[model samples]
Target: MCVSAALLLLAAVSRVTVAVTLPPHTYQTPYHAQVWSCREVLATLMEQELLGCSFTIISVHDDFSAALTPFLVALMITHSRPYQVVSVGGGDDVRPAWHSTSCDVYVIVAKRLLVLSDLLDTDDDSWDWQGRYLMFTSSSSANDLQRLAVTYKLQKTTDVLFFIRGTSDSELAVYTHKMYSKRSLKLLTLWRDGGFVKMVDLFPNKVNDLRGQQVRVLAVNHAPSVFSIIDHLGLLHNVSGLDVKVVQGLGRALNFTPVFHDPGADLWGSILPNGTATGMVGQVHTDDSEMGIGNVFLTEVRARYITFTVPFDFERACFITPAPRPLPTWMAVSFPFTLNVWILLVGSVLGLTVLVPVFGAGLMVRDYQELHSLSASFLLILAQFSNQSTRRPARTPMQVLVGFIMMCGFVVSVFYSSNLTAFMMVRAVEQPYTSIRQIVQSELQVGGYSDFWLAIFQGSANQDVRSLSQKFFRFDNVTKFLQSIISRQGVLLENTKHLEYLQKTFLTNRVGESSVRLMLEECINPFGVGVMLKRNSPLKSSADTMIQRMREAGLVDKFFKEVLQEARGPATQLSSNTDVGAEGINPLTLQHIQGVFLVLGGGMCAAMLVLVTEKAVAAGKYCL
Candidate 1:
């Protein structure tokens, strides 16, 4: 009986299913939608296979809960009869700390997919799940998947597959689905499996002997976008007996294949005798990180090891900005007089003080002696007290002294009044005027119509800018509002700095210089500039290319001249911050140098005057 029971227990344990824990439920809508959608697609793709598997969607109902942490999730999943498992959402969640269970499959999603790909798994770890299956996924469905896959140490023949759906139908659909009217079903199948070889070798020099010979040798530069196609075709072309020659920049080649160790070392020289890499190059212009000017050499001479062609010397890049303009003279001057404001204030004070006293005395007037003399007394009082003229009135000496003192007090009062008015005007312009919060309380208008709307949504139409406004602030402008910010009194809630830059670009002393102005105490969220790449690719190399070619060709000088012209043109002016920054610095300085005409003319005149004096002195001495 004991032996029979043991056998049954073992059988039961073996039959137990594999289970997985899903992440928390508190993900933002878009994040939730992506995860759920991925799951939905995955379920549909492998629904039949997952039927008997016990899968649990483990997630926190709230973001603050410690219970939904990856450690706890792992503990829960492992408690059951673990079989195959997939881990998505990488970093600490799937570090080697987690003890490998009977389950073998693992999937990971990277936060910033392309950064630090070198640190990721680079060896063939697929066999760790030889009997089972493991898969990795990344949140960066754009511009990093290929490198991510390579870093994860996934082998070409390995069961692991990488997939990234495009954000638009026009994107991948262009090359994939719509490449051919009625595409070959077999070709489509090959492409779908990511099994098709897609690369081409172009030799501008040698054509015949290398035409069909398999070219295993390839040199890729920083352009990773060109790699996927290059790598795929490289394999096929080599197998087909064609000498495949891939001449490329540095960054792209490193990402495509991980065969070379220590990427930073060098590939431009004959360093790699092992033939893993043919051409190596050092990054050019170490000062400029953005400019793609890798200093490497390449040659076509075939060898058992890597080879390089003579460095493809290209032209240097040129950067430009709007030229400088002569600033308004008054702008540089401190508030002059502000005299009108002071005058208005003084007049108001004097009128109020004099009228109050006259009205009070008029009420006391009674008989003929008082009435007749009162008119004369009033006139005498005015003349003596105001001190308008030196002409003395027929009044007592005491009255003259008292009147003079009163006139001094009145003059001081007027001055005080003027100063008070000037202060008020300055204060009014300094107070809080417009912001996202203030916009809710008041009506506002915006310029750059489309961009203002698009920037808020991350370019998604489902959630409009108004909806975002309502979410952040309760008020809503349901009606389509026109650009009403043109009027001086109207308010504009905007990213002030951006508008400031745009103002210089589009409305500089041109037709619309006064079109828009920033109100006091108004600022929005600060935004930074970003460089975008094609979805599922690395940073585009052209930014680097532009820097290198220009530096080599000395076109950078010509570029500076052009940029200065633009920066100083009448239609546009460069903002102090934007044009003075590194990219635009050269152009801004060039404009100033070109506009030194006044100084040059003044120096010439001084020299001519000295020469004329010397000549006059010589003539006088000779005549004497």
Candidate 2:
């Protein structure tokens, strides 16, 4: 045991002398000077240009990130800027916090090329990173940078910078991506020649010139918004509408070629139960189309899945009901006066019939024997009211009473004659439904060809709107729906422009008379209508700019008017003899004067019944 201990002591002493003799082993520090250079460049850019901008650092903890993170934190502390650091262990380990944070700039630091690629491959669309500047620190080759830019579809609008660490500690290559050009990778190296660092623009403002790039657009054949003419082969020959014109104007101004595609089967898409969209919205969300434009309205639910441009137009949803029909001939006789006026006239006539007999008896001034009894007095007064000849009274008091009765009867007859003549000539119509409440109370069912019409109002705070939604129905066949409207079976809920289009195109007769008419009360006030695009689309800014300019120039309104006029064409022109009043006054027919004949027949029947009643009374008195 003692010999083993001495040997171990000798080996320890020899190892200590050998370790002391080894010439102070040293290795190069990874990215030592490059880290400092990056800190300096970032400090200058942030202080001078990116003031008040928050930053986010995403790192795969490594030797280089370990060295760079401390310097960045120190710089941020010195400038008193808010910054967050996210350490990624794997692709799935990326924290969702970084995605939701409101950071202006993002710096991704990783050692391996795979790590950087994996970090960028995350499919999170809720975060809007298109407007943010992205800086990548990796040792990947410049070619790899180009591949990443192309693969990730980083457009010129997105500022993507790469800081490539060279073999030596002092060597760092700064590059940016020019997405439209053939050589996408552009070098903007930081020159440090005369003991001072020449500041390089790390994030430069790039003009988003699409450079005649072909962008796919989703659209449908919605008239006035979009009218598509297709050939026999189902190939679209031409397209025209206010929305098409707007898109064409945008294409001209932005120097981009818009290739429109129809979102077949899914006309104007809707959100599904699974929180996914189908139709034009789905196409844009899936990156199959860059934008959608065909009278798409900006709604809160749709806005959650897509981005809408500044509204180029507005939509006023209205109800279209059947036109008021002409009043029946039976009603024309009574239409001259209201129910209350008719009641007052009857009451005054009866009251005078009773008073005339009493007055004749009390004053003892009766010259005619007909004024002695109630029945006889009624007949005499009725005859006077009918403006017929009546027996004259000799006494002054009786004459005065008769004159007053004549004056009242003459005034009422003159007013009734004038009113009846006007009513018969003008063809008065029935009262139409003027409000949504009235429509709800009516037997007419509210419906439209598109579900979107009623879907938008399902969540309304107004009780009337909610009740209307409950009564709403969606029709698949537009022809049937229009027929229902014409037959007064249903009331159509649609945009005002669309309702007008339908009236002019389908509901009008050869003489330009429409069977359907829009309600006076609007169901929904005017709200903005706009184009839809994918969330965080790069085309948003340029498209918005061009649309705003077109609006200012009044081109939008001009396009709308032109489309509507063309749609109307000469098919809906009013004929010269269309209006009855346009020619001479309309002559009365049997349909007009049938009510007067019926009144005469009723009077004859009443006279017969009175004669029978008097005979029965006399028979009973004789039997008694």
Native-vs-model 2 lDDT? 0.71
Task: Give the TM-scores of the predictions, in the order they appear.
Answer: 0.27, 0.76
RMSD in angstroms between candidate 2 and the native structure over all alpha carbons? 10.0
- lDDT, candidate 1, 175-205, per-residue tens: 1111011221111111122222333121011
- C-alpha positional error of residue 61 in candidate 2 after TM-score superposition, expressed in Å: 5.6
Scored by lDDT, the top model is 2
Candidate 1 lowest-lDDT run of ten: 1-10
Residue pairs whose backbone atoms clash in candidate 2: none
